[model samples]
Target: MKDLLLVLPRLARMIGSLLGDREVPLSAKVALGAVALYLASPIDLIPDFIPFVGYLDDLLLAAIVVDGLLNYVDRSLLLKYWPGGAASLDTAAAVARRLAGWVPSPIKARIFGGRRHTA
Candidate 1:
């Protein structure tokens, strides 16, 4: 608990930086906007002042947004700015695979290059 408390400021700064960065994908920007709005709201889906479980909703929502945004962004772009975000690309790929489900090989190839898969 103490450890998390110590790290919360740093995490907030990172999220702020990501939100302010112009190079982040449109989807990422949108997700960040949602997060910002949620944080600013006086009423939340689950209030943070409660016990440990109070944060679960926020954590899960953040995860889903980050995962979805990452799917639309190139790994290189995230790597260039948020170094840790690069590592999350694999998780994003898995999420994309789950969400997009078997993109046509030809369309995938066309979008990504000569030969490639969406995930």
Candidate 2:
């Protein structure tokens, strides 16, 4: 819980940067927006009233969005808008990966598709 409290602000800043970045693709922005909406909506896969488990879905969805955006967007562009240093970025990525691990492979594949390669 303490760890999550620390990371959430940084993640929020990163999301803001991504949304403001002109170089980021529309699709990525749209995906992020959807995630935000999902978080804000009263309805959820797991209702917010359920204590710790309630928030898990929101965190998982955020991790999925961040991971997918990292894969889809140019690393250079992402780095450009990232307010944090390389170490911070790496930490954020690691956190996202850890959260994503809780999700099944099939669901990840369905949401993110196959691995994307940059030219």
Best by lDDT: 2
Compose the digit string of candidate 2's lDDT tens values, residues 1-119. 57666767877887898788777677677878989999999999999899999988998998988877677677777677677777777777787888888887676555545455342
lDDT minimum window of 10 residues, candidate 1 = 110-119
Cα lDDT of model 1 by residue, 6-106, tens digit: 43454455556666766654456666687668867777788888898677667655544444444445555544544345444454445434434334445
Error of 2 at 71 (Å): 1.9
TM-score of candidate 2 against the unseen true structure: 0.82
In angstroms, the error of model 1 at 101 is 16
lDDT of 2 at 27: 69
lDDT of each: 0.52, 0.77
Give the TM-scores of the predictions, in the order they appear. Answer: 0.52, 0.82
TM-score: model 1 vs. ground truth: 0.52
